[model samples]
Target: MSGNGWLRPKKSRQKLRKRGLDNPGDLTTISSRSSIKNGPGVSVDKDLPPLPPVAPLQAHRLKYKEAHSRIDTQRGENRDYTALIHALGLEDPFDDDESWPRRERDEEGERPPGEPVVASLPSHLWTQIAGYLNPKDAVCLALASRTLYARLGKAPFEALRRPENASHKLALLLTLDRYLPRHLLCFPCGKYHLRSQPGCEKLQPSDALVRNPVFVCPNARNMLRRAPRHRIAHGWSLPFSLVQLATRAARFGPHYGVDVDALARRWKGKSGDSEDGWSHSTRFLIHDGRLLMRVVSQCFAPPNLSPSGQRLLLFSRDDYFPYFSVCAHWRDGELTQVCKCALTHVPEELPRGPQSIEAKFKNSLLMGPRRPTAATAPTLCGFCQPMRRCPKCPTEYLIEIKLSEVRNHHHRGGVEFRHALVVTRWSDLGDGSAPSTSLEWAACNGDQAGAGYDSFSRLGKRAISGIFEAKISSDNTGIPGRRIMSMNPGNVKGGDDWY
Candidate 1:
């Protein structure tokens, strides 16, 4: 009887019989394996829960992003960069003058001897080749190999040490920064000093610099060995070390240096010789491998000022420099005239005209108060209103006369509205390269060593006042319709026009 019971069970047979499928059929859910179209393939059913709609979290795009992260330069990701560094120098970093992908010694510190071809070259030939190179390049050439170093000897290094070659020597030292993250290059001493404050260095004003020396150096008190800084207004100057810090963090990683926001500062000088009653605020931004600085200086000015009065208001009595921030080449341009031209636009209250007392009384009653003559902000002329870029430096200036509110404790209600002159300077400090090698920094400082920085050629058409303002334009006011023009088309200097 057990052997004869090979058919379906009684309950199953009853269910199949009830559904009229006692025998399996093609494409039936009960025994779909018999389907001729596709074996074990799922069939659509309204009552069945839908197969999870193709998961996007781990799709093909996941691998694509993983591949992209391997080569992204902004985040400083590099694939086989150690191998590539054995190729050409950093300036021509991607160039390859070898037959194979170069790599360094293994973990055991074992490397093959110098190339036979390199050793075979005559010393005179190497000397001749180095003769055409600058001091920095010559040093780099010597450091490339022991064979080259022996051929070049100490001549290149000796030449780099001469006082005249200070700039060149600094350039050579800056290239070694990657190997020494715990040190910062001292431009004056031409050496890398151990960082005193390390990751937590703060940039202070010129007065309180004793608190945070970037490094301890015997030249700290030396007047000539002062850390290089750009004058941002009279009392406030930006130390170049902070520029190095901000840019290094952007290029490499955050732990190497401080974030850009940490460098931002705002302070008011109420009782200083140069910046009395002036307010200065500085902001920094990193764009296109360069550090952009914006120094906004504002000071309240009285309306209807004479030429002498304008000079007294704009120029500080101590140093005779403008209270606003400017580059070293400010004197050789129309920047002074631009500021003066903007000052002339301050709306002046004219003498009151004789009016009908009855009409005046009626208007006075109708209006809550008589409208002031200088109620609206003044508009500057085309010559002065447009942004002016220093032709010789990577600096741009915008002079504006705006109506600003000032709170004075001596006033009746401790609040007053007045016209103020605002000067905004934007500069593109170069890409953390040595100050001597950075064209923008040297050009801004008017150092004769870097005369090759043609502002129009290097920066192109869009660099004027854009690098720094691109960040805060949504919150603060921005220059919308203004065009950038050369500050000094004639390049005239020390002339009556500037005076």
Candidate 2:
């Protein structure tokens, strides 16, 4: 195997020898044998196979053409197709009016050549085309110009006015300035007419304007447009006094005051010379903790009021101070006291009260637990002082409670502690009306709420202590009995008194 390398390259000679061994014959004989073996097969030398007979030009051309064909079937160019259509037109196609187009044609030998039939679009088609345009463009195209706007049909405008369609409102506001009557644009009505009417002396300075009507500016006209249409049967403009009060109050507070007369003059000029005036009320501010200036009790129409027409409003001391308390009017002057527990701590004891209520100091109001959800429920968590006034009781009180669960092995489940508070009412109640109530309690699971129900299930189980007392009711006094005493089991009750 090594010596063969001297003659031809060793691997090339080996491959050639392997091929010779496989052939073992002449190449020409191999083809002759293949032809004999395959029945009726043509030989390579046999007349080169008749060169494929020539095809007709038309057939070959059509076969070689691309698959797609574009046809331009517009007017004219094809007389035969047009003649066929004309023949069909001789009889009525749509209805029994065989003579309609044909009759007209018949009256005039034959219809003129090259005249196209104009088709009319259906109403729905026009609406669809108009809807795509913006409100302004739609109005311009469909309403502003009679020729174009009329054809659009009223549906588009109706669609625009819908409350959900802000664009419609904007469009109406924009267009109203151009067309609204003078009386409709002014606040008090009289000034607008005098200024806008022709031949009015107030408008005499612009004499040419009287001769020709000038359209109001778009910005001015737009201010008049509003919807959910209803007419104001009656309206009263604010008096100069009230307007001055509001403007001055806004500009000046306990900390600063503004020029009232100068402000009034500025306002007067804006209303114009008229008996019926216009006033704008902007802001009202509270100074320190009280209304700096009084407004008419009817400043805001009271939806509900006491028999005496007194309206009640409530506010929290926390709004002005960190600890629990509220500002109240006693006898005459305003006073502030520690009315309840500060909300910062949870599982808290209630506030303590005084024995003989001092002139300036009142008894401590109940500050129930800070946690709202508690391990147990108490039927009287919301009970108040049965008596209107007592040395040991605060007239008004608030209770806020939140519940949280604490871990314990004895109980299968944890207990939820309640946060509760009782504070004095912020507003005054005439005699027997029930006060509005609110609570700030929340229920939390042991894993998240912190403690469990068993924490205070048994007497003396709760380590947190707070003093509580109920008003000696008339029934208890008649029976010569002592007042009932209890504590908030869970801090569930939360929120203060309402007038």
Q: What is the lDDT of residue 254 in candidate 1?
A: 78
- Give lDDT tens digits, candidate 1, residues 1-499: 7886767323221111112234346344432213223235545455544433323333355567776665757766567676557544565645454765346423344455556787898999999999999999998999988889999999999999899988777777877877777887877778888888777766567777655787887777889777777787766677788788888888878766778878888887543544387788888888877888888898887777899998887888778888788898888878999888888888764554656767666766776343334547688898998888888889988899876777666533223457899998999888777776777888888887567667877677776576456566777455575788898888787766555
Off by over 4 Å in 1: 1-168, 270-275, 349-375, 409-415, 474-478
**What root-mean-square deviation over C-alphas does model 1 reach?**
20.5
Q: What value of lDDT does candidate 1 attain over all alpha carbons?
A: 0.75
Residue pairs in collision within model 1:
none
TM-score (C-alpha, index-matched) for candidate 1: 0.66
